[model samples]
Target: ILDYFELTKVDKEGKMLNIYLQEKNIAPDGHQHQDLESKGFFPEVEIQDFPIRGQKVALCIKRRRWTIKKTGEIISRDWGLIRKGARMTTEFGLFLKGIFG
Candidate 1:
């Protein structure tokens, strides 16, 4: 997909692209910690495609964020770009299944 993205426009390294992923996490609502619950929120995936463009390089995922909420617990899951440039593609759908399962 990077190759495809490159076709349209070069995404230089360190150029931050903000991605919003619907994450289920327990965020303090400032109400109470006594009764904690899992709430869905859009967690940002902040990362840069590395190596910098104009230098002719592959799309390198520099950084990303992922979180899972389990009331008194949090877990980090694996993330990968199943598709690039295109939003919510079939590959992205499969990636969700992999994450959920």
Candidate 2:
């Protein structure tokens, strides 16, 4: 999940009773990417009962922005499917797909 990728600064928002979130960094180091094959972590994710919508509350990660923590460098990457499910989302997937996708 995002925590595994060291994603931080989690923020939540609600518009029309829908749920949304924002985060940054693929990892705590902010300069490395994890190997999904070995880590077995998904890139995108969806969350249910986010605001306790009685089975209607949901949140999905559609994109991400990757940058160096110190230098503010934007790393170039390829396009790929983001992990689905808020509990399953990872920072790596967001960083790549956010820019390329």
Candidate 3:
């Protein structure tokens, strides 16, 4: 799932490290087709990640959208990288659980 994101930029603001990523061109239906056209990007979502050098790290991910030329259906890949009901990566959530639970 992490491989879906391509590292684009990185920023450091005080005690926070922000990592910007762009989602790779992945077929929503799990099969590549010629009818898919680049539509745009979804709203940026921030998900907390493991701290680095005592600085809070967050991943700003931008998921891509596509439009099917034949049907004009908007499609986007639903990558379940974040934990349920939490603005954090699944791996980070599991790490916290291991420490606190």
Give me the candidate number with maximum TM-score.
3
What's model 1's TM-score?
A: 0.21
Better of 1 and 2 by TM-score: 2
The number of clashing residue pairs in each candidate reads 1, 11, 0
* Model 1: CA > 4 A from native: 1-6, 13-87
Residue-level lDDT tens digits of model 2 in 25-69: 344343365321122223544544333443344454434445554
Tens digits of per-residue lDDT for model 3, 31-82: 4854798888999999999999999999999999998898888889877799
* lDDT, model 3, position 53: 92
Regions of model 2 farther than 4 Å from truth: 1-17, 25-46, 49-55, 67-101
Question: Quick one: how many clashes does candidate 3 have?
Answer: 0
> Candidate 3: which stretches are off by over 4 Å?
none
Which model is ahead, 1 or 3, in terms of lDDT?
3
C-alpha TM-scores of all predictions: 0.21, 0.27, 0.91
Worst 10 residues of 3 by lDDT: 26-35
